[model samples]
Structure formats: structure tokens, C-alpha cells
Target: MRPALRTRRACRKLATALMASTVMLAGCASAQPAGTQAPASVSARPSPEATGPVAAVYKDLVYRSIDGTDLHLDLYTSAHANGQPSPVLVYFHGGAWARGQRPESWRGYSRFLQRGYAVITVQYRLAGEAQAPAAVQDARCVLHWIGANADRYGFDVDRIVAHGTSAGGHLALMASYLEAADGLDTPDCEGVPRVAAVLDFYGPTNLAQPYNGAASGRHPSVVRWVGDGPGAHDMDVRMSPLTYVGPDVPPTMIVHGDSDDVVTIDQSRELYAALQRVEVPTDMVIVPGGGHGKFPDAEKARVAGEVDRFLTTIGLP
Candidate 1:
């Protein structure tokens, strides 16, 4: 058997063992109500040891500095490296793009380390700090940072995968699909590397649409991020992932819950249809009774399996 296949099988077995132990997998938090705040638990940072063992862990590494503020990321390399550089899983945490810490759920992502993949969780400006293209720009800068530091970190730049849930998912899509021509790349870290694949978990695709329904009005979080200024609608169009969909975009896997009231499954459906129209390699997994990111243990396990298969199909290292 090929080495990659062997590594995949081993990861699958590890996942099985973790499931049997009733570990709760990491997923996005449900959308906070329009007038509410994210729970304190969601905003709290995880301790360094929470991520478990890895060959190395670099915490709070500054990836970008803008307007007197510095953005950070945490890197966790696999302990199983065999001299070959490892594929990278670049993770963006989700909290309606307003709240949530980068290290919110490191334990849940430890599986990637066990599978010989380097993992990175990023911190970007939130709705309160900056809006719309700001987070998007930071996301692109992260890719550039990875590309610049690949050799030092033993990362395989050719196999970098972007993964995120909810608002983070939107950032992942924007970062992976948008090119230098998009003008979202930061001047300091211009020129993002092509992402190998994208994993979007119930992220909003079209920001122009009213959240939930026309009667529901726009989602407050989105309004906070996009602002209700004179150019709000235009910004909505420019910031939308749907606006940039094209055949050259990386292979993408979308996982959504049919019953999701937060982001609505239709968002993923529309993205899937658009990708299909453009002939991009794409897959969608609709969880029957899943709501937002609150999938049941069984469903989460199934989704993990599907993710593994998708990455394998795309030839991720």
C-alpha cells in the first residue's frame, strides 16, 4: 500500500478510537441571536497544553501587523513527520466574525497532528475591530505568511488546505478563491499561494440576501461586519464568496445542516450550484437534522469520514 494510504488508514483508526471514547469533535458555535453576544466560553482562549503533543508548537506568532495592531496564529506540527514536509491545515475559527478566540478548540483538531499534517489556527480582525475586506485581507496575508515560511516550518506549500466554519468559512473561501487581482491582499504580505483545497462548514455565500428570510431583516452580525453605510450593498457584493467563484478556484467541500437556521442550508446549495456551473470540483454533505454546527456525535463522525475521503480524493499529502 502507498504511504499516504497507510497514513490515512491510521488516522481513520485513530478517529474511530476517539469516537468510542465519546470525545466531542470541534465544530462552529451556533449563531448568536441578533442582539446577543457570543457566550464567554466561546471567546476564552485555550491553554497551551490543550492542543496535546506535537513535534513543535509555535504560539501567538505574529502573521500580520496593521494600523498599530498585530494579528497572530498558532502552529502545530505533526509528531509523525518522516523528513518529508507535511501538508498543512490552516484553520480559521468562527464566531459570526465578531467573537471567538483562535485557540478556542485545539483539542478537536489534534487529529490532524496524528495524521502527519501541520495545523494552524489564525486570528483575524473581527467586526468590532474592522469590517468586510479587513478580515478577508488578513486571511490572504495568512496564506502569504505560510508561503514565505514553508521551508522554515517544513510545510508543503503545494498542499495547503483552508478550513473553517461559519464566518471563518466565508473567509476561507474568499482567501482561497481571490487572487492578487482581487486587491484584498495586504501590501505587507501580498501574493498568496494557491490553496490546494477548501473545507467550508455552513458559511454564508451570498451576503446580499437577507439572513434567514426577507422578513427576518439582515443579520446583525453581518451588519456589524459590513456596516450599514451608503456603500453597504456594494461592499456586500464585493465581500461575498459567490462573487468570486470561478473554474480555477481550488476543489471545495461544503458541509451544511439542512435544518440550520443560522446560516441556512440554501447558502451552501447556492455555492454548490455556482461551483458546478463553473466546473469546479466540489462536494456538498447535507446533514439531515443538523442545526448550525450542533451536529450529533454520529453525524460529526460521518462528516469527519467524508472530509478524509474528500482530502484523499484531492491528493492532499
Candidate 2:
């Protein structure tokens, strides 16, 4: 059998066995809301720096700023969604919350666009700019911005989803689980809308758990992101996506590679267990020998299929 097929079959077997054994488990973008008028300083068109073809695209739309540094987002759709609001997928890039830029390959998301989904890629303040809560706060802000301006962007506020890989995955989960009352608020984004679903790719769910990754605990980069000193432990719990898991978390799909040495497989496993405990709708797809984000093309295709089914199951188009 082809490697992808073999991987898919093994994953299915693993999922089935886990379900029978434990009854199991679970489980961007910067555009403003639909009708909120943009300030004169914000531009609605793609910046000159935006490259590649897309049905329609907008870039560097400022969502928020801290200490005068503007955080922006890029949005794309197969066409100008006019008549009806389209479903929105908010993507956060993975760089251990310390580095990484919003993905620039418009074509990389063609499959989702062809499936009638609008993609919104967001840039958050990284560890270099700030620290742990800052990225989470920015993530929550992006969701609220989408809701406040859902009409302008032609997306259903109720149909917004979060997708991310690695550290980005943790942020995506936080976007879905963090409560507005829990201090994820900003002057502009006071409340966070419910996340429709979450797609997590090999994300570290629990910061408290030691995973063998460059971003793991007390690593200079992580310490910088989470802040240093005696209170770091408390801060770690607060920033952990795993800490936020509860009944209110939206439906979720988690894909992890069993052989992943970066973020240990146990991270996802523990999360799956947590969601299962809460009886949340959750699914796990394990690539038998996959690495962090480097799965075979066939395996990637399988993941795409899983995403489609998960979205549809959660009532998204």
C-alpha cells in the first residue's frame, strides 16, 4: 500500500482502538468586522508587498497596536463574497510564539477557497515584541474584530474557525477557549465570539508539560515569551491552551505525528484525554511516522479530508 494510505489506515485503527478503550476524546487574521468603518489611516487594499494570485485579497489591515506597534492581518477569498457571508478560517502561523510570519502563499490555501471558505491570516505580537499573554490577547482581538466587522467582510460571525500549527496551534485553542471575563480583553475588543471549530496541527497543548521542542519550558526563547522570575509557573498555566479546555470549547480536530520529537505526542494525547473528560466533540488523526509539520503529500491530503469532514460535522460549510 502507498505510505499515505498506510498511515491513514493506521491512524484509523488507532483512533478506533482509543475510542473503544477510553470513550474518547476531543479535540488569525486581522480583518475588522463587516460594517465598522475603517479609520483613515488603515488601508483596505492589499499592500504592494503582497504577492501571488488570489480571488480577492486584502493585506496589512491593522487589528490592534501596543506601544505604537501595529499588528495587521491578511484576508483572502475566492471572490468578493457579496450576497451571503462566507465562512472564515483564521490562521496563526507557527514559530514557537517567538518568530514566524503570516503565510504569504495565497495558493497554498486554494483547497479551502475552492471549498467556499474565506481565509484570514493574522500577524500577532511575537515574544520578540512582547510576551505570552500578548499573542493570546492579539488572537482574541482578531476574533472580536471579525465579529464586529463580519458584515463588511461577508463572513458569518457564527461560522468562524481557528487553524494553526505548533505554537500557533496553542494560540488557536486559546482563541476558542479563553473567556472574555478572564482578561483577554483590549480597549477595542472587549468580548470574544464563540469559535466555531479548531484545527490544530501538532500543537503543544500544555506549557506546563515538558515537551522536547525549542519552545519548551525555560528555554531562553520561551522564558522571554512567558516572562522570567518567580511567577513564571502561574503564567505558564495561564498561557497554556490545555488549562482553558472545558465544555465551552468548540468542536476540534487535532492532528499529530506519533514520531514527532519536537512537541511530544503526549501533548496531544493529554489534550485528547482532557476533552474526552468533558465530553466535547473531538477527533485525533495520528500520522504513524510523521514529524512536526513535515508529513508526506499523501498524508497531507488525508489531513485535508479530515478537516473537511470535521468542519462539515460542526455545521460549517
Candidate 3:
């Protein structure tokens, strides 16, 4: 059953408290403040070419630039073998919409590349640059760019998938669910951008109901991303992927921890129920002892296997 509309107010309050607590939930860390110097080791690295049957990577390829800041992505492809366009998995990094970088290493994605998929990890505007919708806008822009440049990149645009963790999960769903919505007014090349599926990892589905028992207070980070101004309420609704769920949403696979303390398990439950009500093909995997993004190696492998199976079930490459 669908959640009651009254849950929206409760969930919104939870979002605020969660933001103020500084709890360091996986993927929900506070944004890196400007001028806050970091150890030199954290910077993004350069891309590398494929040596064998592995992947050839194009790093820091600029997708769009706005307000003097450029958004970039890393494209990883298996060595050109049969002149075939590879299936794509566009990755969005997680950091509570505030911090995080694109894939600098194939630490977790080697399987996909080995399986002949091209993976594009993207960087988008954070709360430090703008706010809620800016990241979402950047997401749309990247998809459009990927579609427009697919031929040149040897990517199969029709079989694209959007995958993300935590906040990135939220953005991935937004990119897919809001495909028909009016996009930001950024200059863009012509192409239809669509996602065949969404892979969500513990992302908050309903901003209003991030968790139960959230104190009646506003979270500073939430305020920063969505703004606490007069338009904030509307902005929250605008940025939430739940507001856009419909029959047309693509196939979705969600993996969340049952013990997740940061975002709560109910978020995924509600989302899964909602998708089922709409009759969209959907699957949900609940990691028994998982918390936030913490899953053991075997569990991680299980999730990876599930992802591959989901993609295949959906008729994707």
C-alpha cells in the first residue's frame, strides 16, 4: 500500500534533524566546505587506457561548465573488440549532495567492465556550488550529453542504466523518473535522454519521510541544499524523486540495509511498495545487518550479482 500523505510532514522534519546531527551516515557526510583544505591525497586522478581485455578509461572529460565551474566524467570501456557499442552504466557518486568524487579506481566496478559494459562515472554540482535542483539539473545534462555523443563514444544509448548510492541514489532516480519533466535551461545538444533502469543503494526516496522519530528541527545541510527561504517547501517537493513516480518509470532495483540507522529501512520499503502499486517491474534486497552503505564482501558480491541479473531481466545489454 502507498504511504499516507500525512507521512510527508513527519518525514520532512526527520530530514531536518538528520541533517543537523552530524551523524556521518554513509554517503550522507557533510559537504566539504570551501577553503577547507584537504590532504593532497584526495584529489581525483587521471584516466588510463586499457592494457588488455580490461577497460580503456577517459578521465575528467568535461560534460558541461556553468558559473565558471566545469562538470566532468570518466568513461571506462572494455578494449575495443568486435566494433560493437557497449552497454552503459552511468554512475553518480554519493555524499549527501554535498561531497564526493567520480570513480578514480575500478575498486568496485571491474566486474561490469569485464562483462563488457562501459561505465561512466560523473561529477555534478554540489551544495557548495548551488543547491538541490542544481545537482539534479547537472544529472540531466550528463544524460543528454551521453546520448548526444553515444555514437562517437561507441556507447549504446538505448540500454543505459543509472546507478548511485545514498544521495547519488536519489539523483539517479531523479534522472530516470523526471525524464519528461521540464529540465534546467542550460544549453544542451539535441538528443532524447532516457534511463532503462535505476540501481539505488540506500537512497532516501521520500524527502518528507527520511525517517521516523526525527525531532522537530531543521537540518542545516538540508536547508543549504533545498534552501530555507520562502520557496524551500516547494523546493523539497520539486527535488524529491517520490513526487514523480508514475506508471512510466523504468524498471528499478533497490538494495538497502535493514539496519540502516542513517536513512532508515522504511524509506526503501515505502518506495518498493509504491513501485509495486504502479505495476513497474521492481525488486528490493534487504541486507540483514547492513547499516547505511556497510555491507560485507560476500553481500556486496550478492548485490552485484543481483544488479547483473536485474539488467538482464530488463532486456538490457
Using TM-score, give the best candidate's number. 1
Q: Which candidate is the best by lDDT?
A: 1
lDDT of each: 0.75, 0.72, 0.71
Work out how many backbone clashes candidate 3 has: 4
Backbone clashes, each candidate: 0, 8, 4
Q: Name the candidate, 2 or 3, with the larger lDDT value.
A: 2
- Writing each residue's lDDT as its tens digit, candidate 1 over 1-317 gives 10111122343343234332221211101111111111111121344553444766677777876766767888877877777898899998899989987874457787777788888999998888766667887888889888888878888999999999999999999899877755445457666789999999999988877664544356777777877755565566656787777777899999999999889898899899888987888999999999999999999999999999998888875
lDDT of 3 at 4: 48
Give me the runs in candidate 3 sitting further than 4 Å from their true place.
Answer: 1-49, 52-55, 183-190, 210-220
Give a tens-digit lDDT track for model 3, residues 1-317.
33343233444454455453322321122432211111112223344445454546576777776655667787777764257888788899998888888877654677777777788899998887776667876787778878777777778887788999998999899888774323322344234577889999998787754333435244445666776555455456556677666677889999999998777788788889888888889999999899999999899889988988988898875
Query: What is the C-alpha lDDT profile of model 2 across 1-317, one tens digit per residue?
Result: 10111122343343233332221111011111222324322334645433333456777777776565777888886453445678888999998888899997567777777666788898988877666567887888889888877767677888888999998998899888776545445556776778889998988776665434445334454566776655465555556677666776788899999999777788899889888888889999999899988899999999889888988887787
The TM-score obtained by model 3 is: 0.81
